[model samples]
Target: MIDSVKTPRSTYRQEQADATRVRIADAAQRLFARDGYSATAMEGIAREAGVGTRTVYAVFGAKREILSVICERWLERAGARELAREVLDTVDPVERLRRSAGWLTTLYSTDFDVARVLDAAVDEDAETRELLAAKLRGRNRVMDQMISSVEPELSVPLAEAQSMFRAFAAVGVYGALVVDAGWTPARFESWLADALVHQLMSASAVPDPAHP
Candidate 1:
């Protein structure tokens, strides 16, 4: 009878490859973040990772793919959607909305690489652009889910919840862009946090007569 257990060779090789790919991408991220995408060459990434140029290309295909990987990493590090969800779990609808907006602004202001990679992704390579779009769509879905969670605590329609979702998204992206607008990192972060908090408070104060 054939053995039921799988061979370890495939699993071991896959794990090894994943480690190598991660190293390459990490190097690419650092290089791309320091030097704009246009200036970061494949050879530089290989040198940084102590890998061959062929290996870098084999792992990421091109510079744009590397950028996408970095962006994905940045988003994951932020615990972004989960943060928004946490706010929605609160019983107070106003607090929930305030926390949601604050969460986004804080995330964007705090994570430098995320802002950098996202800025680079815009109007960049086709692959990177598509990947960024997919990320945004996924993030928007997360926002909508959070909105639905808060609706029970407020007198708002599901449509209004979705509106809040879009509004927060715009605020977050705008916050990210502001980081590049010549403000010191600390100043930008503080101003963004305040701006988003004010917006959230204003939104939450809206009288929804339909309050259950």
Candidate 2:
């Protein structure tokens, strides 16, 4: 019989590495949120994570990579891709728009701090600005996909539909109405659903304008 080698040791090592990555990411997120991206150094992140500075660098390479990981983590935690799948699967145009709004609401509400941190960092860091641009492009792509799903029902031009979708789904709009204006999440969602339906749907699909 051939000698069988155990793989548990390797599995355990991989688990340990994953745990270390989570710890470092958590520490970096805290520092970045509290201190701003530029102010939070790798040394500080390593200290917060209880690891050596070289270890942080070895894992992430640079602070920008750490921030990118944080953004990706936030997106995963917010179920962004899953929500997009759900939106794509829905057949009704109005429902698709509502789901899209819901996705944005969930994302902004759950990761508002990360968004704020990224927004602030963009002005001061070129790397972060590029990251933000990539994120925005991703956002626009999602919007385009969503708009295409309901294109058959829309009366407006595709370009106009996409622009309106992007405007209504903006994070800043949610931040303003919910974060700064003190509106509840449910209220924001309700308003967003109503606004999107009104703005994107054809006149035949929309509620009577005189009814308020």
Candidate 3:
């Protein structure tokens, strides 16, 4: 029946609210990237979104919360959490390692402005630092799980393998290779895949490092 499929009034209202929050978060992210995070204010975000300042305050309450939403949206665009799951789910050792590289490459290429903003945010108050730290811890946990999936097949110890994963996934490598040196995203992905395969996989079990 048509009535059975009708949208609830409450659900519609909630969806509208969520959409407004995303708009504010996205507008704030642009400002944070253009101006430093400390320099970008809630008023600027409201002005950019063409919304009242009160709406932003009502939705996110603080700039830090808006940043948190931006980070989440960025990750969603990167397919990062899903890719991490795929890496762990992969049965082949070579394939698993290669998929991890894909995940890292995807993240670095997916609007790296969030990383730039977070770097600037580190100089902020302790609460903001804690938020960043917590986010890093969550990411590391996922990385550890991905590496652990192929641990016995790795050339290095578990801790060492995880450390390698962390190092190669750093924004510095992406910045240097892709942003500074001007390598294309595909080229950077290829380089990282090869580097990771050589560094982490045993010679006998290794396959071509090209991502699928």
Q: TM-score per candidate, in order?
A: 0.65, 0.86, 0.88
- lDDT tens digits by residue: candidate 3, 1-212: 55558898999999999889888988998899999899999999999998999999999988898989899999999888878877778888887888888887788789888987876687888888899998889888988888888888889999999998899888778888898999998998888888988998887787545842
Q: After superposition on all CA atoms, what RMSD does each candidate show versus the true structure? A: 6.8, 3.6, 3.5
Off by over 4 Å in 2: 1-7, 124-127, 207-212
What is the lDDT ranking, best to worst? Answer: 3, 2, 1
Instruction: Please list the C-alpha lDDT of all candidates, in the order they appear.
Output: 0.68, 0.84, 0.86
Candidates ranked, most accurate by TM-score first: 3, 2, 1
True lDDT of residue 122, candidate 2 = 68
Worst 10 residues of 3 by lDDT: 203-212
Can you write out model 1's per-residue Cα lDDT over 124-207, one digit (the tens) per residue?
667767877887777677667656665555445677657755764564455455654665545554554444334433454554
The 10-residue segment with the lowest total lDDT in model 2: 203-212
Clashes of 3: 0
What stretches of model 3 exceed 4 Å from their correct place?
Answer: 1-12, 207-212
Report lDDT (Cα) of residue 158, candidate 3: 92
Q: Comparing 2 and 3 by TM-score, which wins?
A: 3
Candidate 2 structure quality by residue, lDDT tens digits, 23-117: 99999989888999888889999999999999999998988888888889999999999989998898767788788878878888887888887
